[model samples]
Target: MNETVNQPTYKRQRFLLSFVHQINGSVSVTDLQKLVFLHMMSEDSNYYEFIPCKYGPYSFQLKEDLDILQRGGFVTLDYVQGSERIKATGDFPTGYFFRIPTERGKALMRRAYREYPYYSINSEITDRFFQGEELEQFNRGKQTYAQTEQVLFTIGYEGKSIEAFINTLIQNNVRLLCDVRKNPISRKFGFSKGKLKHIAQTVGIRYVHIPDLGIDSDKRRSLATLDDYKHLFEDYEKTLPSKKRFLDEILMLLQQNTRIALMCFELESNMCHRHVIRDYLVRTNQVRSVDI
Candidate 1:
């Protein structure tokens, strides 16, 4: 006869494998961290203690558990590059991390689900979390902004193809594309102001360049650390109050188009100045912004 595993050990393994399985057997480690954090928050489970880290919530215990699982042959780790082919790019732009489950992992998760159906509650929570609080607020805000109005959307084009970028805008029903760059030129082929505008027109979206709302290239070029970005954005924020004219213009555009997306080059919003602009608009105009 096979030895029975302890309940606590089984539970932890089940939860981890089930979570990975629920996301189609493959998830970025960063995304898995966030999903688990959200799961803990929603279920009030004390499975892990998460602290606010550089990339949202993180848990050392969770990391350790994943390591143990990998060592035991429960899962496999793979590193992938982003779909973009930009040469001489750093890890942030060029590298992608993923966790994939082994056959053993899938079998364990299936057994756990079959034995304890209650664990399936996490699937619902995962779906809702992906919908995002900002998206929820945007849906609510539409009633007040205008019948046809939608929330402001922000996106980064650092590691995406032009097709992917354009599809994202269309999927979100964006009516305007606001280029929040001090200089609207990029070595990335389709992102330069002229090329970007032409593509947006082809898809029936209006494009505008808002250089005044952008951070200077000099300030952005040397951002090797998070502190550097923080300091740069802090200084950027100080200048915003004086740019009332530009802010008002943005508001006017929003009022007319209703669904506008701010475009930048950073993959993550927190690492970019576009988030600063979004927060400022939300703070002053009582409007919601969503990153798409």
Candidate 2:
């Protein structure tokens, strides 16, 4: 939990590098991703979560973690057969691989595709990894999860890895994400604007950030009690009229897209300003908002 020259600042980052260490040899980035994806399934920790991607189960947050570890000199990476390769290096924390040994050799990747067909839905190489009956089975799993229901939603990423957060979005078939953060920046890996937008686009979800709909940072500083949050959001409600155009724009998005979620930093909808916006939309348009 503490920052250091030899340690990854977050548990998730450590676990990621631990997988690289488990390999004991350089692993292709693609294979490392599949390995970690498979590992996350076996481990109960929400330290890392994943979304189905072009290369099967992928975690944008994990990618960011590797980048950070690289910058910190705890890992090494290079191009391998047109894909990036990863390996543990000097000062990398050793013996931290958490999960009991699962599968090894070729079975790991095969198991990843075979067992988790949903994750391999959009996989660019599913065909190569599986064939015949297996290929057909994989095909059956490729159905898109996006839905056509008119709903407003609120989701907070307080304790979730970005991968877990996006996984939730993909699972709920959320078509658009309305970010109600005033600054659209974060210490969290993928929630920051640029990274968040990239992840959204990768998963075919739209991202919209409306600073006007957010509670300013200065006012968010020392909320030590429920009464504090009450006053903070109460003041947030008063600013809605001045932010009417932004509210209408979000409403239009939900109207047009059918499934839109308001995103913010708190895990509980009650603790985030996005809930206030959700209330406003629901009261005005008679559309209910679900907390995700």
User: Which one wins on TM-score?
Assistant: 2
What is the Cα-based lDDT of residue 56 in candidate 2? 76
The per-prediction CA RMSD against the true structure, in angstroms, equals: 15.3, 3.7
User: Each candidate's TM vs. the true structure?
Assistant: 0.50, 0.84
- Candidate 1, run of 10 with poorest lDDT: 85-94
Using lDDT as the measure, which candidate wins?
2
- Model 2 residue 237 distance off true place after TM-score fit, in angstroms: 2.5
Q: In candidate 1, which residue ranges exceed 4 Å CA deviation?
A: 1-147
TM-score of 1: 0.50
For candidate 2, lDDT tens digit of each residue in 1-292? Answer: 2245767878778777776776767877767777777666776556667888887788777787888988887778898668687878854556674553456535666788777878876677777667798788778666566467788889998988787888788878888998988899889778899889989888788998887777778888898899999998898899889889998999889889889899999999998888888898889889967899
Cα lDDT for residue 97, candidate 2? 48
User: Clash totals for all models, in order?
Assistant: 0, 0
How big is the positional error of residue 277 in model 2, measured in Å on the Cα after superposition?
1.5
Q: Give me the runs in candidate 2 sitting further than 4 Å from their true place.
A: 1-18, 43-47, 90-93, 96-108, 131-133
Q: Over the stretch 1-292, how does candidate 1's per-residue lDDT look in tens digits? A: 1124221244565567556545553566766666676566556776665532323345555776676656554556667564211111111111222343333323433333333332322222223322467435434433332336558889999977665677677657788999988899988757889878976776568999989998878777788988998998899889998987988888888889989988899989998898998899999999878898
Model 1, residue 130: C-alpha shift (Å): 36
